[model samples]
Target: MKSPINLEVVHKVIDVFRAQYKNRDLAAKTEKILFNLAATGHRVSEQNFRAIVGHIRNHDMMSPWFIVSNVNTGYWITKDEKELSAYLDQELNRMSNQFDNVSNLHKRLRHGKTKGTGNQASLF
Candidate 1:
């Protein structure tokens, strides 16, 4: 599928990091993580950023799987749908597991507290 943003520009952006610390092999991956800068002139104004995005949308060249994660630190724009799907699934599983773990711990603590503090003799 055709893409609106020239990948060369994107690669150049990556080159900035590669050049910074004299790292020879950064190994440019197939997926691109683009941090949405929006507008460089104003820190908060999203006008120019919206314009650029609008133009790209008008072109309608982006793939169906194209998405930008509004994650903290930077925006991740990836064309690799398969990779993104797997990554999201992994994150979902991890987060759910963590929540379950916390919930279980809380329940255990609460149960133990109730057992120790409750007046069992009165019930008997």
Candidate 2:
């Protein structure tokens, strides 16, 4: 079976994300959009993918593609499919950590205690 992720393809998707979102925080949104596009069974070109990845990487976005492909050819470096799966698993784990951190921060800010306590704290 072929790998689901190709560096070339990831590059293209990144390009599309940059063009469409134009913001660093657009990763999750871009992922959803790209997933929808991909689910439609449409194929994207390598050059376009490379351009996209380049744009995102240039802007310092966290790209999960680099974990799979070589820096030069945007091609897969691993011959084993299991290795590729493992790489993706690691990336997802990293993303989950980041998400947890952000979620905790947001939760803290939302529930932050104000100056006045007792009755106000109870109300909150």
Candidate 3:
């Protein structure tokens, strides 16, 4: 698994979003963290900060997977079978990894120059 992003980068991205949105809540969080770091007199680099914030924003803004629902007689109802099936198909296509790994392994084997071992023990 990839390593978690550095705290300094996370703080930088939060700072930029707070600046852009002028959100007091977000700004407050950023300020609290940044101020604590400053109190210790440790400075994080701007470039590293920007990159981390960029990654955070990119990840944060992703749309959720959803299927539409309807209400009838003051009751919430599940989506129609057709709509549900379509949504399932789309989500399955998006999440499927069978082809991706298979093709990569095929390409690697095709390009590899290694020959079979001549000894019977090697085959075993």
Candidate 4:
């Protein structure tokens, strides 16, 4: 059986995440959080740390406290509802664009296959 994630580590990470709201200089990246935990002799695996963060984000813990992540900015905690709503909008737009791109790619692949122009046809 897989071992449970350490509750102590989860709380520690939450504390560190909350501190980022106060200290803008402190980055809430995965590496930074891991480093902070290590400094206090709390050794947590990166996988475990990510899992904990995902849970916290999923449950929307500490209402009005939003943990938003973006490709450019990584992860960040915000108390402003406006900021959180904007982030949600941005993510939705990004995912929509990605879905369109993927659909177009699939159409192109199908067109090529119908034309017998697929590059790896003989490899089968």
What is the TM-score of each predicted model, taking all chains together?
0.32, 0.31, 0.25, 0.64
Judge candidate 4 against the unseen true structure and give its global Cα lDDT, from 0 to 1: 0.70
What's the lDDT for residue 82 in model 3? 66
- TM-score-sorted candidate list, best first: 4, 1, 2, 3
Off by over 4 Å in 2: 1-51, 54-75, 112-124
Give the C-alpha miss distance for residue 74 in model 1, angstroms: 6.9
Supply candidate 4's per-residue lDDT for 52: 83
Model with the higher lDDT, candidate 3 or 4:
4
Per-residue lDDT tens digits for candidate 3, residues 1-124, read 5455676645543443334333222223334444444555645454444355446535653123111212221111122466546545765765566555465555555455444423222221
lDDT of 4 by residue, 17-118 (tens): 786633223446677768878887888888888788777877776456766766655677777677778888998999888776666666666664654466
**For model 1, what is the alpha-carbon lDDT of residue 92?**
83
Question: TM-score for model 4?
Answer: 0.64
lDDT of each: 0.40, 0.48, 0.41, 0.70
In model 3, what is the error at residue 8, expressed in angstroms? Answer: 6.7
RMSD per candidate (Å) reads: 14.7, 15.0, 14.6, 7.4
Alpha-carbon deviation at 109 in model 2, angstroms: 2.5
Badly placed stretches (over 4 Å) of model 3 are: 1-4, 7-21, 24-37, 40-42, 61-124
| Reference-based lDDT, residue 53, model 4 | 76
Which number leads on TM-score? 4
Q: What is the per-residue lDDT of model 1 for residues 11-58, given as tens digits with 9 covering 90 to 100?
A: 343333234312112222212212322122222123333444444445
Alpha carbon deviation, residue 41, candidate 3 (Å): 5.7
Model 4 clash pairs?
Answer: none
